[model samples]
Target: MDTLKQQMEYAHNITLENCRVAKPIRFTETSSAYGGGAEGLSDGFAAGFLWLDKLGLAAKYQVTHLFRQSFFGGRYALVDMQLNPNPDLFLSVLYKRLVEGPVFQVTSIDIPAQLRLYAHCVRNAYYRTSWSTEVVRFGGDKQTLAIMHLFHYRVSY
Candidate 1:
């Protein structure tokens, strides 16, 4: 996880220094070969993507594959060859539904390394209200906690 963080920071710095106009970094392909099968793959994917979103470093990122053949022997794909959704697919959906643009900085004092929290604007159809979403991950567990707060404002005509 630290390595992932370092790599992002390095990339962000390099882009800032080298580019004439700022361009958001995009991860064309990223995958984890960790040994815990689909569950492990989901954990890695969520961690990396959420960290990127938290830092506002990525404009876009694509996972390695949507489907992998049985003979491929890698859990990187979002689905099996038969089109069955993997845990990563569900995570990706939830992220898309919950997180929107304008990332917010989250600060903590001596928080445990295992706990991560990211805040973003909630995706809403209505333009008159405000919403906040928090994405939290605890350790390497398969569970992700998402907390969303909605604030409504009335317009006076």
Candidate 2:
């Protein structure tokens, strides 16, 4: 996890230096560490996604594979050969449904390294008024806890 963070930071720095205008930094392909089952993979993926979103380092990311096929192997596939959804697939769906763009800065002091918090605009489809969403992640051995809080308000133009 530390190594992944360092790589992301390096990439962010390079992007800032080379581009006159801000360009979205994307992770084309990524997956959890090896030797884990569906649950572990889901936890790791969720943690990584939350970390990236919290830091605003990645505008987008793609998981390694969607289908468990021989060509790409079945290790990190989101679905199995029988087309059953993996645990991470649910996480992906929830993320898409609940989170919107324009990541907000999160300030914290004396927080544990395994705990992460991120804020974003709530998906407009879910509510008529403006709303903010906060996602909290606590990672532990072989498990992760994620909580989402929504704040709603009206904005007059």
Instruction: TM-score each candidate.
Output: 0.60, 0.62
The per-candidate count of clashes, in order, stands at: 0, 0
User: What is the C-alpha lDDT profile of model 2 across 1-157, one tens digit per residue?
Assistant: 5565577678767867898976666554454434433444534355445434423334322122222222233545556566776555555566667767666665645445764445566788878645444443454554433332343333211
Worst ten in a row by lDDT for model 1: 59-68
Model 1 agreement with the true structure over 1-157: per-residue lDDT tens digits:
5575567668767877899977666554454434434545443455445433333333222121222222233555556556676555566567666657665665655445755554556678636544453434444645423232342333211
Off by over 4 Å in 2: 34-73, 128-157
- Per-candidate Cα RMSD to the true structure, in Å, reads 8.2, 7.7
Check candidate 2 and list the clashing pairs. Answer: none
Candidate lDDT scores, in order, read: 0.49, 0.49
Q: Where does candidate 1 clash, by residue pair? A: none
